[model samples]
Target: MAFEGIWNVVMPMGRSRELVRFSKTDLLSSLQIPSERHLLVAGLETKNDYFEGIPWIVIQHNLDVIRNITISTGPRTESVTKAVDLYLEQIKVRGNKTLSDY
Candidate 1:
């Protein structure tokens, strides 16, 4: 199946024992990034799990596209912003390329 559209993303970072939840509506509401071209990556963090620095991933529904979303425990705003950028870049690189090129 083709992967497109917004998706809920959740990721953990560092050793913080907290869960970060992002709703699909929240992603649509964000003005900083265009929701139409973004795939949301959000999830809950459990106490028994470790983020391993790359706890969160915002990948498209399509297996061909793999985007990395990094969630930070210190300043949430900064981390989220960075994740957005990373997502966008991934989309551009993966989606914009031709299948035969790979």
Candidate 2:
């Protein structure tokens, strides 16, 4: 399957963890980087497996080209949710602050 589309994912690389926004093309490009050999070396079709292998928790917001959603696979569910929650909280705070400025 062609992994092409906008996806919201939490990718944990080593000790560092952060939410990543990726278009399928962007993901393919990342796989080209030498540092990301682990993902490319195996020629993995299921890219999410490298993160945490299992059925990922997917929340679909809309049926459009840009699927702005959160995805987490396997035992790392908690971490993914936490990261997404934090991101949402930040957006909420920023929205509130913007309203206050008005």
Candidate 3:
């Protein structure tokens, strides 16, 4: 048998969750990180006894990437522009990086 890896992000919603699957572009665009080199790191992958020792590589990678993004909006935003502005502001505060930072 061949080892076929599947990557995804499972979001917690109350007692349930949603599955999000994406490619490299999705991860990059979501984080607003222009460079893959900025996100990828050495020895970032992990292996567990999870499901018979298959490594949870994708989960680890997603966790790291998602940490740098605001995937959800706050309650008071009430508008797309405000939510977007907030995300942009967050990125600005974290570092002087934006859509044009590349």
Candidate 4:
């Protein structure tokens, strides 16, 4: 039995590759991992024994935001929060402009 794993995802604006774990969808013929945010970017999945994948349009995390918030008990929480905020801002400002007029 084979299992899905993380793959190198070239950051949109940066020249670095980030490893993101994604699963192959049997129904959608896509490699996507659902999230609370409205959207995300999915790169191509080439291990096509079962199905081929496509580069999906990025979107926002949807549903309950509070439930998605991580519950970590530590002093470094503030730093983590700041880092996440920065990432979100980067995505919001730079992520492929889905709605051109929006």
Best by lDDT: 1
Global local distance difference test of model 3:
0.36
Candidate 2, 1-102: lDDT as tens digits: 132232445565555665555554465455432112222212221124443211232212111101222333433435344433443343343322221121
lDDT, residue 70, candidate 3: 41
Candidate 1, position 75, lDDT: 53
Better of 3 and 4 by TM-score: 3
Residue 25, candidate 1: C-alpha displacement in angstroms: 19
Give the C-alpha lDDT of model 4.
Answer: 0.30
lDDT of each residue in 33-56, candidate 1, tens digit only: 233232322221101122211223
Tens digits of lDDT, candidate 4, 1-102: 122232323233435555444433331223233321212211112123432322232222211221244423353435344434444344444334222212
| Residue 4, candidate 1: C-alpha displacement in angstroms | 25
Where is model 3 poorest over a 10-residue stretch in terms of lDDT?
Answer: 41-50
The per-prediction CA RMSD against the true structure, in angstroms, equals 14.5, 16.9, 16.0, 15.8
Clashes of each: 9, 0, 0, 12
For residues 1-102, could you state the per-residue lDDT of candidate 3 as single tens digits?
001132344445555565545465676576554433323321121222222111333544434543454423333223323433444454334233332321
- Say which prediction, candidate 2 or candidate 3, comes out ahead on lDDT: 3
Off by over 4 Å in 2: 1-74, 93-102
Q: What is the lDDT of residue 8 in candidate 3?
A: 40
> Once model 3 is optimally superposed onto the true structure by TM-score, how far is the C-alpha of residue 47 displaced, in angstroms?
19
Model 2 C-alpha lDDT versus the unseen true structure: 0.32
